[model samples]
Target: MNSRRATIADVAREAGVSPSTASVVFSGKTPVSDATRARVLDAAAALGYTGPDPLAASLRRGRSGIVGVLQRGPLGIAFTDPVQRTTMDGLADAVASVDASLLLLRPVPGGPAGDSGTAPGPATGAATLATVPLDAAVLIGTIPEAAADVAALRARGVPVVVIEGDAGEGVPRIGLDNHDAERCLAEHVRRLGHTDVAIVTLRSELNVTHDRLGGARDVFPDAPAFATLASSIDEGLRVGRQVFAAGRPTAVLAQSDLLAAGVIRAAEEAGLSVPGDVSVAGFDGVPVDGLAPYELTTMVQPAVEKGRAAGAAVVAMLLGEQPASVTFTSVFRAGNTTGPVPESRGVSPR
Candidate 1:
């Protein structure tokens, strides 16, 4: 049996029209009379031709319609983290206007810096982000993991955008006021009469972690700091257990909502009453599933807007249009999870 995919030319022949005429009917780039369009549709239906191959079309246009997004950690985490997922959702919405799709580029451990591959070992030069046929690229968190790839991309003239982090100058940035937001959250704790505080943080190197921690320290310079591998509930719980074990601080500042929730769980498990015996706060005002009765005092960053901005930046740069880097501010929310430090848990009075 000779089975071959039908092409636009074949549909044109079957419809008794020239190939260009048939192509126009499908592309809708040029107007075709209803009679001719109907003829082309009928012929396409008969031939099982579901329009032109998208890849082929993009290739002919010298574009891939694919944007490279550096997956920060496990791909699963992206779906689970509200900030990551919401950002991606926004990115998808923005890219849809240009008919673009995202390719999550996972970093390869033990591979040269900036190599976006699945595993350590030889990565095909073509498989690298720089050589890959992507219209543009966006770094998820920071650029350190993919700095070399970014350089290669720049050399190749591929547009690059970094979300929530810095990649030196000239790269379009989708930034948030992390330092200011952190300061806001920490100041709230200070106003609540919480002097002795513990800070739970995400990965230490992340810009989010740095800014949030800096903001808190600006208020509580001597506050003890604990770091987690990721902004996750389990990590929060783990570090929460450790922090509480060391002697409960009057208040705790967690870097993300998920981490904050974990710390809350730890406090509860340790028989500490939240805001009663201990006050806990978090950043990234995301919903904490099942952490009821405790609306967290947090900073709500624009996760979705950040993603959309990154996607839009890519579109702009690809079109030879330079877009100014954008910075967004986070609003502080006074949720139920925090309160004045109990006199019993605070520092010894002089």
Candidate 2:
């Protein structure tokens, strides 16, 4: 009667069934006689009725049935970051196993130009990322600038969980032992009699300008350093050039294997060899892409398992379980990248 297009009412009228019966044919919530269901479905097919409007059903149920997921970086970065990818996979597995879904919401906190939600924005992040309705929200990474959004979610009584980063207070946290992991790598290089070590680093946070190596320096001030913001490979190559231009390090402990591999490449380019001219080490225990024969001395974290744990935690939270925290450990892998500092160092890189 409310003229727009065919609705459940129209289908019910055509099938000579009550509106509730028509809904049952679509949702299968209540049992309908087979013959009656067939009649309702056939009438629906005739009227080109797809099904009940999900919005309407959601409103009726008083739940959106969606979990909002917030990320600080592009989705592609999620794939590249082994930890994030594994965690997401775990979350997805849990959601699927439970017949639930996750809705991605990336909030550009500056309102496209740092305006704070004034300009036109996409439906997902604009509203949902900031104040959209959700049963719960998982801040995939920390967004310090989006503090208001975090506060809003809390005000709405939506449970929040953070993976790999913090989301203010009163929210559940799932984190890796980043400090310990870095310390472990540092200790490995230090124990090898190499005090003159340079580091290749990753972005510290969403700001992207905060030097990861600088932070490391604050923690390990005496550690010699050449830091880069590029991926492990890029950092390796950049630092490798510096090595060739400035001088050689007794050992180089890169932040990641991708960077370590780049260091190896640069070492070879500079007519130096790994473990021969310079002992190299890296983080993330995952295998290198083109490093065929050489194994990297790095810390390996159970990425997928961490994700699964986070997902399970989310499930527990959804079931009204008390919020808790989880931390995963990193296993050090003895590989070909590191060895005793070469007895003969021509000159230390100043």
Candidate 3:
């Protein structure tokens, strides 16, 4: 055996088959006979030929076979959000259909600081969409810096798909009916007779937050709104404490389930029972790990479907097909967390 790496040709020669036949066994694009595939596998094992070189194959096809998923914040934080995880799962399935992998790209400072014009290595600096080899990019959330990220990717001729955010004209968006869905939820709360309501938001900069806030306000125009830095339960707890510290409302409308769970915790700590002292409603129907006892009242958005839509759009754009933008609606779910406003509260029932 030679010290050099084995190629498909080596396997073909050893298996007594044409190179194309040997390649077909690996590609799976064209079917090969079971007997011939077995021979090729045996030959590959004997020659220590693992499989095809993805880089070389991608080069031949003029594609990197990589799609960048731009996270609104740190990768660790993104994974903590159930909605993000569910959406990514759907995105993964969609991208896998097209045989592409996802590369997480985080926002960083301006391009590499030198004359080279090449993106700095990941170790030296955060990877920007400009520096990464992405055939297309999916903007996960509406961060304040999203405009610049979209511009950079578009400048490089990469297709962009936005999930729950606006990336300007020409960028196809997979959006949720945040305003309408949230308004529906708010109306439910209002009918339940919750006039004094407080809103807990994910982040101030997110478009989803803005839409949800707008919806809640549409019902309770003067509702006190508190913004959290992240979508984590801890952030929710932090904001929940503040909102509940002084003259807490009869109900709290949290932007995400995690936030609602945190608010529930805070309410308990403040010696208030959920739906007894303060009714809580949340958006995003994701399950919280520790929130077992209380089934959260929330608007169940199709998070995974949202991701699939974005992934499909990416594939379509890559293939030069013009895919239309997608808008998804949320289903209202009734849970024990929300109920008719406590009669003891001074506010009169509508």
Candidate 4:
């Protein structure tokens, strides 16, 4: 089999014309006589030349038409979180408007952020910024640790926008008021007369978790914090059990609704009634898959809208326009999971 791909030169030689003439015929950039067009078409057909290479065309246009989205943590774990998935969905929609394709970039199992295995060679710290052909890059849930990555991408001339994270100065950011939002939830539980609180934080480094924990701490300064590996109910349940085992706090504040649901389960297993013996609160007001009957007391963040803002920021940067960072707010919601400190258990203050 012939290993070489046919080029415009081959078609031009067969058609007895210059390569420029052959290219112009296909590009339709120049008018050609009917006979000349026919000869070029016939030659191209004979040589099995479909069209100009997409990569070469992309180069000529100075664009790959790809927007890279760097997700925090491993791809497998990141997709499991509904908030990230929804954010990506909105990003896809916005990039589609500009006729650009969305390319998902994930950390190589243990390498680092932007360490994708898909490349010309072994990936390095800046492999994603340097190797991938991206017109723009979006960092999601990568707050508190993406500053270096953002710098590297900027060095390579790739526009960057961060969602739910900060990547230093000049980079447009789409952020939610996590601290205020979580504080709102915490204050609600406080108003219910619960002072003893346990806070569940997300595993690893996330700005939301840190800020949310800070918010909760504002109300209950002495509350202990627990880390959960993922925002799944199972992890929440495991951490919830550990929290209960350690000591029964009158109120358990989870960083996510899913985690709060699991804590409620743990409270039930311990023979404690929610809001009756123990109170619980969660963030990200997203509906838990199996949580019903009881509305979750949480902060409803505009997750998808934040994603859309990031996409718009990317587009603006790509157009040589610098958009200011945008911060969104969350609304507080009260539910059945929390109530006044239980009188039956006489929940003591921690």
Question: In candidate 3, how many Å is residue 152 off?
Answer: 1.9
Residue-level lDDT tens digits of model 2 in 186-290: 676666766666665655553322323544454456655565665557667877688666766777767677878888888888888777767887776776678
Measured on C-alpha atoms, candidate 2 has an lDDT of 0.70
User: Residue by residue across 133-167, what tens digits does model 4's lDDT show?
Assistant: 88899887674446656766877888988887777
TM-score, cand. 2 vs. native: 0.78
Over 4 Å off, model 1: 1-4, 15-48, 112-120, 123-126, 143-145, 347-350
Local error of candidate 3 at residue 200 (angstroms): 1.0
Task: Give the best candidate by lDDT.
Answer: 3
User: Over the stretch 1-350, how does candidate 3's per-residue lDDT look in tens digits?
Assistant: 45898999999999999999999999898988899999999999999999999889888989999999877556875577788888999999999977899988775544443221235554665566777778898887666557677777788999989998888899998999999888988998898888889999877877898998998889889988899998878887888999989677899999998889899999998999998899998899988889878999999999999999999999999999978999999999999998888887745566
Cα lDDT of model 1 by residue, 63-136, tens digit: 98889887767878778888999999999999888888998876666665534442344554434474467888
TM-score attained by model 4:
0.81
Candidate 3 residue pairs in backbone clash: none
The per-candidate count of clashes, in order, stands at 0, 6, 0, 0
> Which parts of model 4 have CA positions greater than 4 angstroms off?
1-52, 108-127, 143-145, 345-350
lDDT of each: 0.85, 0.70, 0.86, 0.82
